[model samples]
Target: MKRTTIHISAALALLLGLAACTQDEAGFLPEGAEGTPIVFTATGLNPAATAAAGTRAPVDGNWEGVSLVGVLIGGTVKAYDVTPTTADNTSATLTSTDPHYWTNHDDITVTAWWPYTEGETTPPAVVVRADQSSPTDFEGSDFISAENQPVSYGNPTLRFTHRTARVTVVLTDYTEGMASVKLTGLSTENGNPAEIAPYDKGGDTYTALVAPQSVATGTAFITCAFTNGKVFVYKMKEATDWQAGEEYTYTVSLAAAKDPGYTVSEDGKTYEVYNAEGLKNIAELVNEEWKLGINITLTADIDLKGIDWTPIGKDNNKAYTGTFDGGGKTITGLTVTGSNKYAGLFGRIGSGGTVKNVVLEGVQITSDNSSGYASGVAGNSWGTIENCSVSGSVSGSFSVGGVVGYQFGGSITGCSSSASVKGTQRAGGVAGTTNSGATLTACYATGDVTVENDGTSYAWAGGIVGTNGGNSILACYAAGNVSGKGSGTIYVGGVVGENYATVTACYWSGLPDNDNGGATKVDGTNVTWQTAVAAMNAALSGKGWQYELKDGNSLPALKKEQ
Candidate 1:
């Protein structure tokens, strides 16, 4: 390990700015006389050092204006704001706002540290931050001090020593603005993690100020996140005790992948999944092993190319009750085909379950049984589904939708689906049949919903939902055509085939050639795709959401998409 230290010492000292000045002129009274104000002058170091953005320290042999330092004499503490006095910055003048005077001839031991805390007599706390990405933030995390040093009133020599250990990670294949590294595997407890960011120094130089602590043996501390999406973790082969005023450097050069695709937290309740197998593991844990309360998060976009899919939950009795946050990542090429009922990415989401911030692209879900249900996200939902989307196609016999086949006794908010749907009984763009006070808020669907008859009786199809079923649909829209063919008493609508719920500020585009399945039809005011985004945004205000177009697409998108 290489070493580098940040040490500051005074080079030259001059007392009272003039050698011929008397004690009265310098405000220094006789020994044990009236109290006198203490004057100060701080000298500079020999070598040059670079200061961060807001620390006001010296950078390249020049001080960045007034540098603040705290001085403590006996039980009193005062601030000393120092400024440069020489062209080369080897000399400086230190002044205090709240001046502390010399009361007696006895010399009081002085202690000092860079940067002072206002309205506090005790020394500042030393809890380091997790983010040191910016220079100002990095500099602010450093606490330098000169403890129990002697001071001369005429020419005080104050020097600062580094109070923390500095660590530098040099990536052999580092790229500008394309790579990142973090110090991991630190001791964390009570829900607080020590996530240390490497302070970038242009090109390949990255340094981090770490609090002095012991690095346990074989602990992987530095995680090198490469630009090609490869991660390499460097472990300490031997335990090293880090002390203040010392620096450690690690040069990394690895040619192989080191990550296992799944990083579980210390508490074992959360998992950051990075691949398709890891995602499948979550489903197996939730359904097979009954680990229903674990939380799963996606760290990267996964591609399900050739792997056959199994829904997270098998049925309503064995529904997924865990929380899954996608971290705004996508899962592409999801294919679910079976004759089983309650089928989708998730078979059923039970009460208290939540799934959000996920996008399913190019999905194909097909149900063979005549009474089965199929969709993109879930077949049936009794929980919360928020800020999710789907595309491609979905087909089934009984109930089918682009996002969910059946929604009951749960809430769906800020979700969208653009997949084309085909079904026999009830088909919809967003949901097939929503009942039991199911709520839909700020949701939209833009798929062509069709109801076909093979051996089924009358069918119903809608743009947003097939059957409202006395639920609540608020500030939602559907921009696709809803139609029916080869069915007895076929019913269709722009919003819903049957409306028995509270529909507030809902809109739809061109549907229901005849009647809106006993419901009112939509007009051009809220149906135009150009202005529909803003209008829906205005309608969903104070609902904890808004709308915007994502990636130059003309369709309205939720905030999670951004």
Candidate 2:
């Protein structure tokens, strides 16, 4: 929020050196243009904002050193101290928690060096105002707001007009929360703009075009809706020349979550509309990530069989319907895995949805290649998980929980884990890491969470969770052995790795062991394994339930030991 006006060599040189120069110098400013501020104005059917790590603008554009001071969204005015990327050329750019900036959505103005102007000794600024002259406003609505559109094939198709362009963004295996609707633009020459698309493809990636004539040369905007009603902007430059009647191919690929719209059958079993007939199996699951509506009560314990289920994440091509309840069923003896990320009950259960009475056993999960935050129950939980258990290993780089990893704001109640969580970094028992707005309750762990060998030792491994954001953890415990030291640092705890969340009536007793380069000593106070087992039995008895410790047994008992 504070601006530091520094007299850098460029600024000082431009001010002092230009003063001594005459109009004869080529790089010198034009005599009459000295007082006129070099101002830039942009207007178009701005696309909805997209995640920065994903796509840029529909046309090729960059905001390398542009200054964006403000952005306007739904009539609300916000301010920004730094620059925002406006590359998509769609409508508005969607902002993510990453990059940390782009969350504000008011008018953007900056005082940095102009993006395209080379050696121009003038200050640059961007000004935006709603086009009152245009009758039809695609300003507030996302792209897929229109119905009965055409389906896409492998690539995105484009249609052009003098003032507008329509692109049908095609994405295969579009899942819940993992939809891909990215179209950015950049100026081919000096006067162009960059932005992220601003429309929603109704969770499907389709073609949407931008009127390059309506946008500047190097600005992009994403016109999609994010969770917190914020607009993310980017700076882009025209990368190619798109002439009228000339067709050029632009590929936009994103890794998003899957959308599962499961319905209950007459036989009390839940079934998903598997896939469209004749659709090539590019992904294991179609649409975005699978989400449940309410609680999916499973009266019977069923096997998932040998189905290669789909994975999902929190991207454009991901979707979730409601809560998926296993209804006290033993969800075991099956092999399920996804490409992006997958949850047991729902992909993203919002800040509601309670997942209880389920057991995830003998499940094998592969690691997410790029963005981490994969979990056994859900990707990034914001609800309550109770009376559940997980017994499989999860591998990813960041944001992983045994029962639930990367909780934003939720509760993990009465759950336990006996799985091995392996990741390149940031691994935890209950949650890999948590924000300051989450709560954990009545949870325990006995897993061996470790980090793989990497060059640097900067890992954040722990027993319960790698880190916590001020929440409540009542009657919870952890006993996992945290290890790995290649670029990893031990933050292990008997109950939690780092407890910003409250731990009441909880304790830890797992053996603290580490391998080479790891801190051999455990981080928490000694609670002893026997005490931990007794506490587990006592909690189960009080709840009229039973539990089994990780003692060598082919078939673990469910009843509490006498």
Candidate 3:
């Protein structure tokens, strides 16, 4: 209920002119006079702006979906059909199903309407379906008619107007989650309240057609149901009678959603968390070991608003051991300032734990004092992390990284980070250090990695891992600048400061050369930001991974659904 701006507008409907006629020896022309083919050229079937299914009109300034009618002066009539001339359907030409002709300058009454129904001798009745979920149904509700125009030899011209009223709802200022809109309180012709389903035009727009009807005041009409468990109602304050050929539009601005309380997923294994409170509650439950292995899913984007946050698995002994599926949602404004041993959104991910499809935005985590492991995601990862990305700033004393502070025997796949990181010992764009047979595949980082030259015996900075200790690194790249701060020699590399085991098809765009304590420039491929997407995808092919280049990103990122 944060947003209060709701605007409505009603506008007059535009009318189009059309002419139609039919063919028969009796209705053709004057008796015994050789008749010429009556010329039928269609015009003016343009759709309203951004109207869902608006472009489906049969005419490109010509005719489509039109049924032509020619009424002889003597009360005889016939209907004909038309076809478009261009393959692109930009224009139309008449193809009379029942050909007709005029002779001796004979005059007759003509009628036309769309869409046409075959086997009907007369103009069809308006067919307005209650449900408009299908776009064609909504378009079919648009009954336009041009009735009773005198047609003589040359060309027939008639005017058409919509017989049903149109209503459109557009949601504005939408920041997160999906919206489902419904229209209620409109009475059907039978005088009972009718619930109308509109056709979604994508981009938060929905449109529907309603037959002319009277609506009473104080009636709840528009309802917007959001995925975050927020429902808004718009009721009419004044009685308004809907009329034919008129259009109504309602624009509703949305706001951040509040916590939706506790909700469980259909499988019952995964409980849904909607807002900041729910997220904090989930962390608490896991930390207490009561729900340590229970799955959790995010149902909406959460904004912490710069409040201090404690990592989920702050206690290493009770580390998170369950799955955390973000459901392609974003977690924003995660701020933490500490010098604890483990620091990040999650301090530790225990064995058998999995986190995927999670996006962290504008996070600020710093552990400036003492030696601590820190990253945007987890400080010590001993489990699987996949299809997740982080963006912001992260710094620590010893192990520091944009993604994970330490990969102590686990796997990270299809993940990326663009958070600047700093540390006195091991620091990198992705993880600070990895050992014990850890494997990384199809991942990249674009955040600058700075290893402070505090004269530490083994300070190193790399675009990917700070010190790869005999681990498997495959199909990964880094594109951030790696530099040594302060004094003393801190080894830096474009890809990894040191590599002991397997490193294949890996690339770097940050360091001038891949030369380091272990693998050198010859061990890795160098690609620019412009050419990295194809290279990463090519390298990751057959490896069950693909890279995509996003706007304003210098490195290829793992694909995540919105």
TM-scores of all predicted structures: 0.52, 0.42, 0.51
Deviation of model 1 at 374, angstroms:
0.9
Task: Tell me how far the alpha carbon of residue 508 in candidate 2 is from the true structure, in angstroms, after superposition.
Answer: 2.8
> CA lDDT of 244 in candidate 3?
65
Q: Candidate 1 or 3, higher lDDT? A: 1
Question: What TM-score does prediction 2 earn?
Answer: 0.42
Question: Where does candidate 1 clash, by residue pair?
Answer: none
How do the residues 68-163 of candidate 1 rate in per-residue lDDT, one tens digit apiece? 877788787888887777777765666776767776555567777765676656556455568888877777667667778777655566655556
Q: Least lDDT summed over 10 consecutive residues: which range in candidate 3?
A: 9-18
Candidate 3: pairs in clash: 18-158, 21-69, 21-70, 23-99, 23-100, 60-90
Per-residue lDDT over 1-562 for candidate 2, one digit per residue giving the tens place of the 0 to 100 score? 1233554655887978776764334233342433212222222222222223232232323222223323222333233222233543332222212211222222333222212133333322221112211212232111111111221222111111122233344344423344223445433333323443433434454443443334345555323323433333333345443332222333333223232223346763344233221111212232332333423445556555465444322432443334545566676543435555544333454566566666788766555644556667766666666777888777776666677667777667667788788766567777777775776656667788876536454566667777666476654666566765564355545555555555555554455532211112223345443454455466556654454556633212344234
Q: Each candidate's lDDT (Cα)? A: 0.75, 0.47, 0.72
Better of 1 and 2 by TM-score: 1
Instruction: Kindly state the number of residue pairs that clash in model 1.
Output: 0
Q: 1-562, model 3: which lDDT tens digit per residue?
A: 3233222111111111111233442355545355665556544454432134343232122344444433232344445455655654434454464456665566767666666555555556555777787866766567766567677666654445566777778878763665667888787664423777888878888888877787788999888776867887788878887766666777866643434344766876677888888888777777775576779888899898667888888866868889999888999988889666788878889989888888999989988756689988898889998888999999898889888899988898888998998899989888899889888888888888988877646688888888888378877787778887777777888878766767766777556464543332322345354455565577677777877767743345566333
Q: Once model 2 is optimally superposed onto the true structure by TM-score, how far is the C-alpha of residue 144 displaced, in angstroms?
A: 56
Which numbered prediction scores highest in TM-score against the true structure?
1
